[model samples]
Target: MDAIDEHIVSLLRSNGRASFSAIGREVGLSTNAAAVRVRRLESSGVITGYQAILGTDAPDGVAGLEAFIDVRLEPGRDSEEFLVWASGTRDVLDAVHVTGPYDYLLRVRVRGTAALDGFLRLLKREAGAAQTQTRLALRPSAAGASARERF
Candidate 1:
C-alpha cells in the first residue's frame, strides 16, 4: 500500500462508515478511483469487512456485572470441550485459550453476582473440576484508556 492507501485505511479505522468521496478527497482521488482501490484492498485481504466499533453494546440475552474470569481447568480435561461449552453460553463476552498457567481466560458479563456465580458453576461443571479466578471491574477501565494515543 502506498501513502494514499495508508491514509485511506487510517481514516477508515477511525470511522469505518466514512464515505468513499470523503476519503477520496483526503487522498486526492475521485470517487470511482477510491472505490476501486478500496475494492482492490478488500479483494486482496488488506481491507477486511468494515465494522463499527461497539462500545458498551453488549450482546442479547445477557446483562450486567461484567467481569474477567481467569480460569484454570484440570490439566487432563479437553480444552476444546471447555471452549465449545463457552460458545453455547451467551453470557460469555469472549474467551481466550492462552499458553499461561491459566488454561483459559474469559471475558464474562452477567446481570449480577448471582448470575456470575451461576456462570462459574456452569464453567466448573463443563470444564470438569476447574479452578476459577474472577475479577469485577468497579468502573469502566478509565473510559477510553486508549482515547489519546498515536497510531
Candidate 2:
C-alpha cells in the first residue's frame, strides 16, 4: 500500500464510518479515487469487515454486569490448559493464578444474570471447574474507572 492508502487505513481504523469524500479530502484524492481504493482494499481482504462496538450498555440499552469468579479446577486438571481455555472464552476478560483458597480468579462481563448463569455452567462443564465463588461488581472504583484510559 502507498502512503495515501496507509493514511486511509489509519483514518478508517479510527472511524469506520468515515465517508469516501472525507477520506479523499484527507488523503489528497478525488472522492471516486478514494472509493475505488477502499473497494480494492476490501476486495483484497486488507479491510476484512466492519462492526458496531457496544459500549458499557448492552445491545438492549440496559447496563451490563461485571463479576469476578474464584475458580478451583477439578482434580488433576492442568492450570495451563485452564488458562488457555479461559483466554479463548468470550466473556472472560482477565484470568490470573493467585495464592489463595481458589486456584484462579476470572473477571467477566455479561449482558445479564441469565448470561452469567450460562457462563458458569459452561465453565464447570467444559473448563473443568470443580468449584466457583462469584461476586458482582457494583461499580468501578477510581483506579478501575481509569484503567482503560491508560491504554
Candidate 3:
C-alpha cells in the first residue's frame, strides 16, 4: 500500500466511524475522492468491513481478565475440527493456530477463576486437551505508537 492507503487504514483502525470527509481532511483529498479510494481499497481487500468492538466481560465497559490457553493436542488430532470447536465455543474469544510446542492458543475472558474452570473443563472434554498452559493479562499501560504515528 502507498502512503495515502496507510493513512486511511490508520484512521479507521483508531475510529471506524470516521467519515470520508474526515479521512479526506487528514489525507488531503475531497470527500468524493476519499470515498472512491476507500471503495477501491475495499474492492481490493485492503479494507475489510467495519465492526464494533463490544464489551464481553464488562457491563460498565471496563475490560476484564484477558487470558490465553496454550493447547496441546493428542497425536493425530484434526486441527480443523479443534479450531471449529474453539471458535464456536461460548467462552472463547479468539483462537489461533501457531507454530510451537502448542498447536493452538486460545484467547478467552470470564468473570473469575470459577468461570474459567468451567470453560477449561469443556475445552478438555471436547479436544481431550493433552496438556494446557495458561497466562493472564494484567493490564495495558501503554497505548503504543500507531501506523500513522510511526511515520
Candidate 1 global Cα RMSD = 14.5
Residue 94 of model 2, lDDT score: 91
Clashing pairs in 3: none
Error of 3 at 65 (Å): 2.1
Worst 10 residues of 3 by lDDT: 54-63
Q: Rate the local accuracy (lDDT) of all candidates.
A: 0.79, 0.89, 0.82
RMSD of each: 14.5, 11.9, 15.5
TM-score of 2: 0.55
Query: Could you tell me the lDDT of residue 36 within candidate 1?
Result: 93
lDDT (Cα, tens digit) per residue for candidate 3, span 1-151: 7899999999999999999999999999999999998899999999879976543334344444568999998888899999888878766878999899999999888767767887788778887688899998664323577857655
Q: Model 2: per-residue lDDT, tens digit, 105-132?
A: 9998887888899999999999999999
Per-residue lDDT of model 1, residues 64-98, tens digit only: 67699888888788878888888888888789987
Give the winner by TM-score: 2
**Global CA lDDT computed for model 3:** 0.82
TM-score of 1: 0.53
Backbone clash tally (model 1):
1
